[model samples]
Target: MVRVLFAGTPEAAVPSLRKLAHDTEHFDVVAVLTRPDAPAGRGRKLMPSPVKQAALELGLPVMECDPSEETFLAALKATGAEAGAVVAYGRLLKEPVLDALPLGWYNLHFSLLPQWRGAAPVQRAIWAGESLTGASVFRIIKGMDEGPVLAQSTVEIGAHENAGELLERLAQDGANLLAASLQGMAEGQIQPVEQPQGAYEVAAKITHDDARMHFNVPAFALDRQIRACTPNPGAWCQLHEAADALEPIQLHVAKAVVAGADDESAPHGLKPGELKVTKHHVWVGTATDALELLVVKAQGKKQMGAAEWARGAHLTEGAFCD
Candidate 1:
């Protein structure tokens, strides 16, 4: 059995850590490395990361320290780990730390490497409307996700799946792949392949501005944006009332769908950002087609059906979103 050191944070990484711990035959998880507890929730009390919580529950020793510290290498070596597995640890490991273990470290990334190789791979893929995305187990190198892949598997993106939902599925599937890859390495049955040379787009972290919805774009693009930002810095737009009595209210779009021609609720010849409310649905115009707003949250209000919110707001005829 290979003595393995696992490093991760957040709920998404819990499955991977649990997988390695439960597979006692091929691996022995010596210790877990994770970030220190930080403020969370409404009261801002210090709380341990999901990985840290899981490690404690599993009766495994846990280390909470930044990987860049000078003592990190010594601490890592003392764990007697021959190899390491990282899953969204949220820190870059330098050269000395990389060489601390004899068998080297591997990372379970959410995207197919040489593409979406950055902090927000899953979000970027969904935002870009990628039909296909996958998980990769790659040997860690000096650069960011610029490593050779040991194993990989492809997955199709669901038509209406948001980033949060897709990530939940990927986390579970990636856990199995990660465990298999480590097991194969221990048995000398798998070989790492050098990544193909190419200039691929980076999945840079998405900001609040990046999540803002612009109705002037095509309906499909708007749909992707809304889905990409569903449960994070949610997709928002400025609700412009007919009279500028108050500043534009922020509206968070929870769900939306492109208005098909057969839908009787969809208004015809609506200009961009134009709002049309029927008894059952609320429709907004985009560049190419209208979008049926299913759920939305107005400023200082709970999320509700778009038509319900429209009725409660008493919006004027020219009221719209931008």
Candidate 2:
């Protein structure tokens, strides 16, 4: 068996770790490396990372510390691990740590590589209206996701898929790809291929500003942004109306669709951010079209259909949203 060290931190990495742990014939996952526990939830109690929790459930030894720590390096060396597999490990691995393992490291990234090569690939892909996005397994180099690919698996993005939903599907698909890559490498049948020359896009971490909805863009672009930001910072806009003592409310839109010009309620020639409230929909004007909001969550309120919220707020047809 090839002794392996698994390094990862988030829920997205759990499936890969589980795959390695179960495939005992070819891989012996000696230890798991994850970031230290941090405070979470309302009480702010320390919470173990998803990877650490999964490792504990599998009765595997886990090291929750910085990869740069000397103690961590020593413990990792003691594991006699011949190889390492990384999936969404939050921190970068230093040269000394990488040298400790004989077979080096393989990273399972959630993008096609050289495409969305950064921290938030899944979110960026959806936000950019990418119809196809997939996973890649590559050798970990010093550069950021600039490694040679060992294997890759393509997955189609659904028309209305949100970032969270797409990520869940890719995580499992990535696990399967990782397993196949490791098996091929162990058998000496696979070789890493250098990334092709091209101008690739970067997927920087999503900031607070990125989640704010911009109605000035086309309705399709706004729809993509809304889907990408769901279950995270959430796609939000400012409400100008005052209803039920809620003025200038920050509304998080959960679901929306591009409205057809044929809709009679959709105002013609209205400026972007202008709203048209109807009995069954809340349409907002955009640069090229209007977006019909389906689900929305207002400040200090539970998620509800946009029409329901409009009814309760007494929003008129001429109301505007910033």
Candidate 3:
């Protein structure tokens, strides 16, 4: 059996780690490497990484440390592992650690590499309105996600899919690809292919500012932004009332769609961020068209239908959303 070291840190990496640990015919997962435990949850208690927790449940040894540290390198060398597998390990490996494994390292990235090569690939793909995205198993090199691929698989993005949903599916697909790549490598049937020369987009880490909705764009663009930011730093806007006694309310838009311009209920020539409320819908004007909000959550309130929130807030035809 090929003794391999597994390195990863998040929930997305758990399936791949479990596959390697349980598959005894080709691979013997000797040890696991992950980031150190950090505070989490309401009480701020120290919590183990998802990968570490899974390794413990499987009775495998685990090491939690910064990969750039000398002690970590020394402990990794002591594992007697000939190869390494990485899935969202969340840190860069130094030359000494990379050289310790005879077969080198392989990374399971959630993108069709040479594109969306960064931390938030899934979210970026949705925000950019890409219809297709994929998973890749590639050799880990000194550069960031700039490696030769051994295996890959593509999946279509749903028209209204959110980042959380797309990522869950990709995580499972990536695990299967990782297992197949390792099997092919052991049988000497797989070869790494270099990425072609071209201009590719980068997916930088998301920030709080990215979650704020910009009404100046077209309705379709705003809809994509709302989907990309859902179930996390949600897409949000501010509702300004004419009365000074009432404070501006922040609303998280959970679900929305582009509205037809010819609809009789949609008022034309309204400025961006202006709202028109009806019994069934809350329409917000944008640059090119209007967006119909289906679900929303006001600050300090539970999630509800946009029409319900509109009724409770006393919103009429002339209210505006900043």
Candidate 4:
């Protein structure tokens, strides 16, 4: 049996941690290290991390440690774990912990490394108009997500996949990949491959400022940005609810694609932020192209089809959307 130390702290990390918790025959998960619970939701209640919840349910010792501190180092070393596995732990592990694990620590990152290395991979990937993104299991090194990869798998970037949906799909795929990587590690068949050097893009963690969509952007860019932030912040644009009354409307651009550019000199004369509604969907005009909005939510309203929003709300064609 291989003694494993697992460090994780979110819903994204829960699947892999649950996998380890059930595999008592193959993996002796001596301790589960996770971040402390913090305020969450509308009431701002302190919520336990999924890993912490799962670890306690399984009767395993759970350690809430500051990732930057050495708070759990002694307890971690006491486990006699030769290996450590991390998934979305939300903090960088220090050199001492890495050195303590003889077999080395492995990280299951959401992106295909050297690109989207930071906290927000899926959201940033979509926001950056990336055609594809994948998962990677790499040996933890000093640099951020610059470690050599043990295994990787790719998935197509669906035309209008939102960050939340994409993350759910990737979580399952990553769980499978992590299992395979662990098997290879035990058999000594897994070899870390060096990361390539190139003009890689960084997926900086998405912020409140990022959720603010600039309607002046090309339709394609605005569409991607909307899809990227959907189900969380929901793409928003400031619009007038009535005369002299500016209301910020949050619309979920649930579907989109590259459109309208037939040639280099194609004509796009539509005024940006111009809104149009079809029988089935709502189309928002952008600087370069037009985006088809699928789901939309007005202030004090539930999310629904764009056509529904058009029907319920008295939206006019000449109405301005900032």
Candidate 5:
């Protein structure tokens, strides 16, 4: 059995940890590594990472430290770990640490090798309207996700699937792939292949400014943007009214679809960024077509049906979104 050191921090990595720990026939998880406790929730209390919580429940040892620390290598060696399995550990492993694992370390990245190889793979893939994407198990090299691939599994992306939804699906599917890859490697049934060299785009982390919805873009583009940012940093736009005499109100848009003849409200003919609120629906104009908002949240308010919030705000005819 392979003595594995598993490193991860988020809920997405929980299944991989469980997979290795439960499969006693092929693996023994010596310890789990994760980032230190972080401030979370409304009260800002320091909370253990999901991986740490899961590790304790599994009765496994947990190490909260970064790879760059001088003592990290010694602490890792003390666990008697021969190999490492990493998933979203949020740091780079280098030099002595990588060499300490005689069998080498493997990382599970949420994108096909050589594509979307960075922090926000799932979000960037959906934002770019990629029709298909996958997970890869690769050797952890010095550069960011620039290692040879050991295994990969592909999945199709739904037209309207948000980043959060797609990531949830990948997290579960990728767990099975990671376990199988490790098993295959031990049995000498798998080999690593170098990634193709080319000018591929990297998946940089998305910021609040990057999540803002620009109405001047086409409706389809805006639709993708909103879906990509859903449930995190969330897609937002500003509401500007001619007579408000105040700064524009920020609105978080959760769901929307491009307007078509088949839509309930047909041919809005509204100017770009113009917002029209009716009894049951809210539509915002875009470069190519109108977008019907299904859900939204006003600043400092709970998320609700777009029309419900619009009714309370009493937006004037000239109110627009930017």
Candidate 6:
């Protein structure tokens, strides 16, 4: 059996851990590494990482660290690991730690390397309207995702896919692909291909700022941004009005479609950034077209269909989004 070390964090990494633990004939996972527990939610209570919770259930040893700590490097070496496997580990490994393992570390990245090669590949791919996206098993290099590819598997992104939905699917798909890569490695059939030079773009991690909708851009771009950050820092904009200090009414738009149809309510001459809200919908004029919001969540409320919120929202017409 191979003594493998698993390093990852977040719920997306849970399925991979479960697969490794339960499918023990193929691996001897000596240690699981994850980020340290941090305060979360209402009471600021401490919460363990999903990887940590899964490791504990399997009765496996787990190490929580900031990844930059010297102690963490020693912990990694203590595992006496033959190889290290990572999936969404959320931190870069130091050189000493990488040298400790026999065959070097491998990463289960969410995008086809040399494409979206940074923190938010999955979201960037979807938001940029990529029809195809996949996971890669690559040998880790010092540079950002600039590693030789060992193996990869592609999946089709749907026209209406949301980031949350796509991530859930990729998490499961990644497990199957990583397991297969390990098998190939064991058979001495693994081959690493150098990534193409100067042909990639960084996927800056999605932030609350990235989620804010800027209708001044093309409608297509705005539509992509909305789907890419959904169910999290959901793509948002201001609605008609606010009560306190002109508090910008935060609107979390979930589902949207680009439309060009001209009905009586469509704001024609009002340029981009203009918002049209009625009892059933909120449409924002964009550079090329108008984006019709189907589902939305107003500030301080649950997510509801745009029509449902609009009925009670009383959003004023011609309330331009700031």
Best by lDDT: 1
TM-score computed on alpha carbons, candidate 2: 0.94
Model 3 is weakest, by summed lDDT over 10 consecutive residues, at 239-248
Candidate 5 ranges with C-alpha deviation above 4 Å: 241-243
lDDT of 1 by residue, 96-140 (tens): 899889999999999998899998898899999999999999999
Q: Model 1, 292: alpha-carbon shift in Å?
A: 1.2
Model 1 misplaced stretches (Cα beyond 4 Å):
none
Evaluated at residue 178, the lDDT of candidate 6 is 84
Residue-level lDDT tens digits of model 4 in 1-322? 7788888887888888888778777788888888889899879999998889988998989888675666667777788888898998887888987888888899999998878888889998888878788999999999898889999999988777889888888888898788678768877998889999887877787776777767787777787777888766667776654445555555444455435556332224557777665566566667877666667676667777777878888776665477
Residues 191-227, candidate 5: write the lDDT tens digits: 8899999988999999999999888888999999998
Task: Quantify all predictions' global Cα lDDT against the true fold.
Answer: 0.92, 0.89, 0.88, 0.78, 0.90, 0.83
TM-score of 4: 0.87
- C-alpha TM-score for every candidate: 0.96, 0.94, 0.91, 0.87, 0.97, 0.91
Q: Judge candidate 1 at residue 287 and give its lDDT.
A: 92
**Colliding pairs, model 4:** none
Residue pairs in collision within model 3 = none
Give the C-alpha lDDT of model 4: 0.78
Regions of model 3 farther than 4 Å from truth:
241-247, 260-270, 316-318
**Residue pairs in candidate 5 whose N, alpha carbon or C atoms collide under 3 angstroms:** none
Tell me the tens digit of each residue's lDDT in model 3 across 1-322: 7898999998989999988888888899999989999899869999999999999999999987788776877788799998899999999987788888888899998888989999988889999999999999998888888889999999999999998889889989898899889888867899889988788999887787888887898889999999888877789988774424267788899999887757777667767888878888888889988899999999889999999988888865457887
The candidate, 1 or 3, that scores higher on TM-score is 1
- Candidate 2 displacement at residue 217 in angstroms: 1.3
> What is the Cα-based TM-score of model 1?
0.96
